[model samples]
Target chain A: MPIRGSDRTSNRRAGGSPQRRLGARKRNQESLSGDPESCSPSDPRQVFTRRYRASIRTGQEPPSQRCSKAIHQGFELEVQLYPLKSQLVLPGDSLTARFIDALSAARLSARNGDIIAVASKVVSLSEGNIVSLRKVRTTALARKLGRKFEMLPEFAQVVLNEADAVYGGVPGVLLTLKNGNAIANSGVDRKNALGDSVIPWPADSHRSAERIRRALNRKFRKRIGVVIVDSRVTPLRLGTTGLAIACSGFKPVRDSRGIKDLYGRKVQITLHSLADGIAGAAQLLMGETQETIPFVLVRGAPVQLGGSYSSNSMTLPVKDCLYMSQMPSPSIMERDHG
Target chain B: MPIRGSDRTSNRRAGGSPQRRLGARKRNQESLSGDPESCSPSDPRQVFTRRYRASIRTGQEPPSQRCSKAIHQGFELEVQLYPLKSQLVLPGDSLTARFIDALSAARLSARNGDIIAVASKVVSLSEGNIVSLRKVRTTALARKLGRKFEMLPEFAQVVLNEADAVYGGVPGVLLTLKNGNAIANSGVDRKNALGDSVIPWPADSHRSAERIRRALNRKFRKRIGVVIVDSRVTPLRLGTTGLAIACSGFKPVRDSRGIKDLYGRKVQITLHSLADGIAGAAQLLMGETQETIPFVLVRGAPVQLGGSYSSNSMTLPVKDCLYMSQMPSPSIMERDHG
Candidate 1:
């Protein structure tokens, strides 16, 4: 449904005084009306809309993009990346409510189609998916593997539980297959954990994302997308960027295998992966370590919406993965391709 | 380096009317000053400053961050992405002048220390880094590989010429190392290329990036950084994000080893690759295709400026690369590591 002016005002006022205190933003947004300056290059919304229209013919966007033919009159088509400042999220807390409240406190309103990107670590912690080193039952195999990657047997035991299969290990890192994604140590991090434990991934990240999306939708009476994000290394590339382990609220990909390019030429091998792209953009502000900003609000990205999405949409079986199919290895792909 | 209000006003006016016509933006900006509501979460600049300061102690940022301890009085710490709408760029065009003109036409001003991200395709085009398939001489090896990947022998010859060494061929793709980076067909793209040809990586991307930076700095009389960006696939992950193939003005990495996290735990094995991070952020707006906004301005990322950097800073030898070291290969790595 379209957002009416009174509806927006009432919504802002209902968010309490902190939201109402945003008089400047509200006033400024209103002042844009009847203003020719809104169409100028200085207006961010105009810039986005202009670029969006120009790129449509180029086939640069996913076909699922919502704003393909939009002239965008008076539309605030701005994609704002807001990094929320939150406290240390501990294990077993209600991450869903925690995020909603924090967003509200940050005065970031949730509307019909806002995406809330959360770091997978925070989701895992909230789900109490952590294992204590003191309570872990480690096997001899666990101990041996732990020594290879400079970890304790307990951490290895937890990793073994979380991993679909352990690929191999070096002195400093171990390659593991988790939720069909190639990750290091199953993305288990002890950096911000309490006492003697580490947080592994939530067993059902897709369901976790769905649950959060549903909760936010119920509370706000509006549809909202949720993406549980993690940082991963790229092949032959340095450092890490955000990867969407799970998503809900839209189709996460644009498969353009036989799609035509701008010149009507068949464009081969172009899949615009929307989820991870948004995650990567969010990761620039949600610093990996102490920037306690696990939550980022990505507004106006032109992504489709619905709660009918799944993790399966983003995963590729090991046997079919291009990186695995071409590599010399004794993993799942060995049986199929090697 | 402190930008006074008068200085900012004069700068806007000097942008020659397009910037001066930003009456709405100027009004909004002025209304923000001395308004207690601006101190709220509604202000984008305040939001950035708060998050930047909050994340500093976590060692999440590069130590040389320009805004490390800055008590930003009133500044716009924004990352503005502008997709330049331009006609097709032919080879040998002065990319430096073209980009400056496009940015100015869009009313974008380059302040001191602003980073400009250029897609490597445009850089290669400007450098005349195209290989005409009609002019190519094919070897037997080229013909053999060409048949494997459905490429003409002449086109395959260009790949051979650009490659440091061919690792082997898969149907539809060939792994080759170009400019010390492992890439598919050595960064050759046929989609936007002239008919019967493809564009490969520039001869010296580092130098290309540096030359662009110098030209921009000379014209603007400001310390501006330049990064030539590319899109590459991640192993086992679908789709691509921006990668910084070459950087001109900053330490593009943030090594967080021996640093403490929020919990005072020693964070290990975390290297915040800033250039690629910024590039990844910029790519979301630039898109892969005809969204002509190939140029993005990444302002307020706390990165230090310097010119004494090279591709070496972002590269690791085949012998040391974890993935390549473990790969089954009889090419460069075998010669370099075996």
Candidate 2:
């Protein structure tokens, strides 16, 4: 049955019917922790967890309960995404400390081996990666890019500055290669920020992720992985899903080479992108709007934790990329180097 | 805590460490059905739920139970994938009935709005979509392709027959576009079957999905969606994730056009591929080995049910495809159309 919703509130962020938006502020929400010392800020409005509230509308067994018996019954291959809502992240705030505080507010503590997915925008925000478009001086190439893509000259300059290589564009969206990923506008975002201001990717995603991982480890006295995530569109697919810009504390790819298949044939080219898959699940919970869920705790993912890897581990070289390798033109590569 | 495994079985299908492979054959596997009349044939080996058993190894609460209280405490946004294992599917079996029986065997009834992800290989097997390499005659082009890609001429013939367009490849893999998806060997599989036989995509994916969806709705007396899925490698990314070959009973894409973003700017190009995301989650559970889990029941996925859509609804036209449209050479298109 469709999860029924109750306690209507005008929430545009969740991007569902009006009835589906059950603002967490009206509910008697409790933290997962029973610690009396736990505290939440004055405004306990958690727009991100509205999906959870929507499940309660029909007064039926929440899906967790419906499958609770399955766990005891010996059926347990599953993955869970918990979108942890927090106070508004401000520039220069310590992400690790802020995340810990958010977990406290949510009453959820970091569990050992949980992979926390932090939004790249928030990472940028904390790292002071904001740029004011009003101060940008557009070059001739930037103006040409603006006219060609139907974007503002200042925005185009920012995109050019961030993108490794620009391929082509539709009106308002440029297809660019950034850090070995084919992303829109090199992962520059205009939404969720003030006027004429934009947030780009963190300067060093791998380093950013490592710092968070170390901090969380120290704070919780537990082992956990960190994945820096950004919303990305798949080629020819609709809507956005999570992409791992950088990750720490795990082998990002599960290489299946030499592994025997069901028929006893050795696997050739199968490397599962563990980080990206986890990121996509987290992004599903962290909606595009002001859901205020910059962190998602992913538990029980089929990943081998306790390893350090670079962000490059998640990206394939252009010569090895399925789409880029197939392109008969060297221009896409030449332009990247150019 | 890492879920530890109790029993040990030599399971190459689950693709994990030895202790992690908790074969389901030894457990008191009771179906979700309390009814004594329910049957699970002679062998009730559910190698798929080994992950669940592993979770129980540490004497800790299963992740599901750990989050159970979250449901009652006004937190509810989550997605759960239940992998259902069944008998070895042979050619010409009725996929719909087989799926229903599998669900019954697991004692998990389908709830309305649950999306059932069926592996496309199983669908192809049931539809008699298998080809015998021994029976095929390799043409000159097939022979050329075989030498170039280090594949059998007979297998190359089959790939050529199934591929919409051919691209460059490495020693043992061919990059091709099949049904608007950039897939290896045009979605043909040589594993899991007897010698010299290969499985390709179902003849008509949309029709296959609709038929399965219709049968499910009738049998369960509940509304549900069906997605035919196949494991696919992402461009430049490692390993295989789920790709939706076809879907029925829902709008595959969530068009966010004209929707306001977090900052109230109208969303331009955000079409969420609900089917693919769900498919990927299901694939994570349905591993590449002989797990015997071809069907996964996904609950509470952020998707709207109740719609009829074409398979084309999930794919982009070549001209509109992000990667395809960026190629500077007309050769790829020419080869495709040729």
Candidate 3:
């Protein structure tokens, strides 16, 4: 569900908003900012915005609660929540159809410059990239490779189907996909689905975005942006954010060069990855195997909507990725093999 | 320079008035939402306000060969480069005064919600948070702590001055600063400055922000935000972003709960950390000691200009930080000792 800042004055005016009652019970907004000592010089007109404020204050009100309450009374914000329903199946036309159905059911129409966050799995499914291991004929080469890697013979076929090329490594092979999306097993999926079924990464995610944007425009008679997003593993952070595999109808990168700072110093090296930020924001809603909300419509983003768009704008060459260079080839090979 | 997208049709327009030429070359047209691929679509006349666009191109285009035969395009942005005038002396009010002088010399004015990015060293200098190793009286306790940890005795004094309280850890301590900014060695500095003088983290960073913001506002009769930024070592990333150690006059945290997805799903986990993004952007301009430009004024940001402010909004508590829990504390301690 979408969380929002509590609009103290408005909630109070409404009289029935639960937040107002909570605010009254607390009578102290000091805890909202976390530290009582720091809030003294803060402008009383400034509104505090946070999600975990309630959770942080429960049973933690200290001796100087009076001052804290006075501080909290000064700030305000309006928060709204939008919760999703159902588990979204990924990587199939059916999944895309389901998303379309959901959008229609909710009476939500895609507006121009509206970014649609589609899960990679759903994109993959729509491309008919699903594999049936039961139908695979395990050749002698497949058996040898499978035995060496401790993988099922049918798994080899699935990997080969998704892979454009393979390079030998200490552990096994390092597979590269057609879109230059490198992965241990060519971006094939085994988890989050039933037995004997594997799913490949979406084919030409950027192309997929364009198609979806076209369909959306046709359906709603409005211009819109499409961001084909995939959860990507960064070198350092655990978990992931949705990276723009492809995009249409928006600029993905923002250059801040030649911009003057507050001190009038010229700024360099300030390219803002707008796509990454949107993808990260979208990732917060599109979870794996949980809350099957596959598509998120982003509104009020800080991007200018409209232009000659291409997904190629956001696609960073594999060589340009600093993190990719850090991974050991042998490790990737091992993951591919076993 | 705030890089922006230009309209394609404007580029094709006939007359080459300076304004029109600028428009054509710069393509500074605002975008309207629509399918990017279609040559012409229904509702061609309809325009929509969009946040993020997909095809905004930025950066300096090498002077086109055709331009040599026609109009010469000067630089797109009005940039004023300011290299440091001299070796800025630290640990005194003179540093702060110099910064203010530089701002005035550059003829930059602060606007409402304009964030001023300042390096930690300058703030450290202003606060007199500097320690001379030569003046330190190393006690038996200092010797013992140093010996136990294989560190210099004077280093302990430097650490003590920077730290408010020592949270338990091996070798070195996890320090909580006076400003409630928790970090190793309280965000102190030893490198790049004069020998034997260690720089402690700024005292009351938020107060420092308030002081600067108020001072500038008084001087210019304009409201502006101030951020005392420090380059922080994150657990994963190779380099650092300018972290808002102190902030004034802006909402640092944005609540995204209740935001709807394209499929009408409510976004639950979308708290956009504005301070971090701004800080990181500022870091691109405010470099290490070499660049010498101490402060940066950011403009054309998408943030709402306001009197509201919070430093707590910029910080994630220890529990909320994903990298902190995952990092090897002992390794960090070992590095500190070494």
Candidate 4:
């Protein structure tokens, strides 16, 4: 059932929605004190916590009450975005094993429907997508595109070499199509790699997610969803938000085409891509700058799970996308750099 | 302090950072049963929640123990994104008053440093930005642009009339600049409007945010940050993410210009736009087909607060913007309708 205004307005700490008939499982979590507190002004953390406390009192369930939780429970409400701190994964390290170990340490196991969001970087490392810039031979186009973007010659060459198509360039960033996903630097990241080598998006990130999900399921013996995510710049907006490179185990888009709005009008053109949305939500906790959090836990997202899905389920070709199709093509990159 | 990998692996809840000194406030919240449970495979929520419960163990802090938190004693850590449900807002209704009442009904009050994110639609409603399609006379330009975007003639007229410039069109959407934001249909929204009239973004969203911030402060006697957000589609990506149209009391951009990454290299091109990220997180709960939530509460996010900021802080000139500068100008729109 959809959450209502009154359900939230009620004084109950959990905003306990009426869907609760499974009373046997409910725990007594009423007296959690991790709710509200006034923090120091000068400390940004204090200010943030202080501000968070005030807002939480009127409109939220404290993190303590919920703890580290997503518990899909078939609807979306009262949620936390948990970015776990983890040590850097060495190239060829078993990311699945590491994640399972971390979750186990923290006392977590995959349920039949949990979605594990792993940064594409670690997946690339595990898949051995890392390549030294020194090993890449620079091409003429790479040099020109690199100089145009004012990027280092090797990384620029890497971007060109990896891309399916080089669309164009803006200051400090490039627009390219790598394996059907539109990304910057062709999904090659230099951030947080162990040494001189940069990491390319896993050869097949969707498969990577599938692999991880299967391994986790084998260990816990439960079906789970997995999405490999990376950061990319949005047009006209500075910085990046998480975009799913690959996903498995759920329909990525929540098609709201025939759903009625509050006015009873059938909503059209309102397809909510659930995987990308979840990735973006995860990005809030895993900020840019290569955060130590390579893994994020999203539960209780109320998504359409079961029946495996691929990253291609939500991806459209360049000719099919809204803005990418209309933009100038690779010829723009071939234009005179000077 | 940056979150460490070992802390997460050590098996203590809250990641047990050695940096923490507020020992007396910490609680032993083990034995919580909200982890993963094997439900029928078709029951995705049960599965998601089940996986979540397992992950929640061994690693996360329980709510009861972190009671009345923020010793800040220093720093910010894990956080939640809460989307609140409220009734439809009428034109000229006091958004601040409605928000205050809604929050009050839910037992939440504004506290020092809290960040209140109000959807630009409601803010526009409060500021009387609703307009009638019947009253809008279609111009030759509007009809042509409308035909191009496959929109209604009068609605087309509004989009054209509201924009500073009509850049171009794609399959199902148009690109326009309303105020400084590159948006679809000049940011006019019809989803939750009362009758035939659609609501446009506030004339000066920056001023609207500033007004809300000031009013809330006067009412609560506390300094809280306010961000006016709207959903927009990103280039090359389907679906919408939150974009900040206006903000008050924080630097929306987190300048990580000289900060060191894990590799100890001075990070560049990692400047994070904090406001936009929070909005994206909020969107995870606030689906586009018009859910009950128009206001989102974000607390404990590490953002610079105080001394006020304008939407311009997160925006760039059209010439300086990465995407807009390269796009075809109005002359291109004026060039051909045939």
Docking quality category of candidate 2 according to DockQ thresholds: incorrect
In the range B1-338, model 1's lDDT, one tens digit per residue, is 11122122112112112232254345444433323453555544444454543433232443322233221222223333444434456788888777766665544567655788888888888889887788887878778877877877887777777777677655666777767677777777766676766788778989988999999989988777888888776556676667788998777776677767777888865776678777776666664653455577765555667646787677667655545555666354323321
Off by over 4 Å in 4: A1-76, A104-113, A221-223, A332-338, B1-76, B105-113, B332-338
Which residue pairs of candidate 2 clash? A52-B76, A52-B77, A238-B271, A238-B272, A239-B271, A239-B272, A271-B238, A271-B239, A272-B239, B32-B107
Local lDDT at A1 for model 2: 10
Interface RMSD of each: 8.8, 13.5, 19.8, 8.4
Candidate 4 lDDT for residue A207: 75
What is the iRMSD in Å for candidate 4? 8.4
Best by TM-score: 1
Best candidate, DockQ-wise? 1
Q: For model 4, what is the error of residue A294's alpha carbon versus the real structure, in angstroms, after optimal superposition?
A: 1.3
lDDT of each: 0.64, 0.67, 0.47, 0.63
Fill in the DockQ of model 1. 0.24
Greater DockQ among 1 and 3 belongs to 1
lDDT tens digits by residue: candidate 2, A1-338:
11111111111012222222232221223322222222332212222123123332222222332232332222434455666766667898999877887666545666655789999999999998999999998878778879977999999888888888777776787777788787888899887776678999998889999999999989898778899988876655655667889999877777766767767876555677778777776776665763567888876566666756878878878776766776544323334323
Distance from true location, Cα of A259 in model 3, Å: 28
Candidate number that wins on lDDT, 3 or 4: 4
DockQ of 3: 0.02
